[model samples]
Target: MLTTNDLMTIDPETVTADVPLREVVAVMNRANIRQVLVVDGKKLVGIVTDRDVRLAVNSPLTTEEPLQRLELLNGFKAKDCMTSNPRCVTPETPIHKVAELLSMYKFGALPVVKDDALVGIITVTDLLNQMALIPEPKS
Candidate 1:
């Protein structure tokens, strides 16, 4: 059976709570990833996704209000945008169970923790790819 250890991404990009929201996104874009783990000294504090970044901008940007948009962006921080202390999974967790937790919580990914330290991350995409790797059953 496939486990989280088999599919989880090791050493995912992580940010601190005090990091500026804009910088967090830069890391996301640089990594071509949609989510980042918020950490404090190797400990998992929260999970931040592209959705969180979108949700941080509560108002629509307008050509007529460029300063206002910039002000809004500057006011946001990772701590303000991140979902703190989200549910996490372990390396031993089954991929199917990870899927269930993600579906139930509407989470984009689950932080993988071990010995109270941030280890890896399991995203829905990982689960889908794992499923795709399964060979077809004999007829």
Candidate 2:
């Protein structure tokens, strides 16, 4: 069984909750990644996904109508809208199990943690790429 550590993207992108939405969006776009871990001193605190940013931009957090993209982006921070306490897996978690969790939850990615410290991340794309690399058994 392949462990998460074997397949997870190590040193995955992360951000502090206090970071502005603009910066977070910039990082996500630059990395071409959908998820970013929110950490405080190496401890996992929350997570922000590309979906979250999209939804944030669209959500009317206040009574203000027709909020412009610039207004929304400048008005919020990661902690104000990030998904708190997202489900995570460990380094020892199996690849199959990770796939199952993603399928079951429709999660874009799962943070990898060990001893409560954020370590890596595994995504559906990662799983697919890993599976594609497997060699077929011969008769």
Candidate 3:
């Protein structure tokens, strides 16, 4: 069975809490990734995704409010938009388990950790790729 280490993307792009929302978007665009890990020193604190950005910008409360309101009210930093205490998996975790977690939680990705250190990330795309390599069982 494949493990997370076999399919995870190591040293994935990360953003600090203080990084501006605009810059986080830029990094996501440049990296061609939907999510980014938010870190403080070596600790994995949170995760920011494109969906989070969209939700923050298009939230009903902000509909009539000026864009500047985000800066004042939301702090305009990765920490503000990021989801803290994100669900994580370890490198030794089975790929099928990761798939089950993602499916059950509707998550696009999960951070892979070992010894409480961020090591890599596994995404739906990775699972799909792995699935493609597996032969179907006889009915």
Candidate 4:
């Protein structure tokens, strides 16, 4: 069974709830990733994604100058924009089940936990990579 353990990224990028959104964006950009796990010492607390940042920054109700926009972003913390208590999966969870959850929830990634500690993360890209590796069976 191709479980999350087979493809989950170990020790994935994480941030505390108090971290600024600006720093969160920097981390995502630096890692070339779309999602980041929000943790409190090893416990998964929330999740921040590229989409979350976009929604927070591009709010239709707010139209601020560039400098003001920057300031607003700096003031925003991970907790202000993160999805709290996000759904998670265990390392032993089947990849297909993970895929289903991701599709159903429109989630970009799912945190992998064991013994209530953050261990890794699995994303849509990870599943796609695994799919590309499977060989086609001959008819």
The lDDT values for all models are 0.88, 0.90, 0.88, 0.94
Task: Decide which is better by lDDT, 3 or 4.
Answer: 4
TM-scores of the candidates in the order shown: 0.89, 0.90, 0.87, 0.95
The TM-score between candidate 2 and the true structure equals 0.90
Candidate 4: TM-score? Answer: 0.95
User: lDDT per residue, candidate 2, 1-139, as tens digits?
Assistant: 7999988898988889999998899899999999888999899999999888888887765444545777788889999889999999999999889999999999989999999988899999988998789899988
Candidate 4, residues 30-103, lDDT tens digits: the string is 99999989999999999999999999888886676777678878989999999999999999999899999999
In the range 1-139, model 1's lDDT, one tens digit per residue, is 8799999999999999998888888899999999999999999999888998877665454344657656656788889889999899999998889999999998889999999999999998998887788899999
In model 4, the Cα lDDT at residue 70 comes to: 80
- Best by lDDT, which number? 4
RMSD of each: 2.2, 2.7, 2.9, 1.3
Pairs with backbone N, CA or C atoms under 3 Å apart (clashes), candidate 4: none
In the range 85-112, model 3's lDDT, one tens digit per residue, is 7999999999889999999999999998
Total backbone clashes of model 2?
A: 0
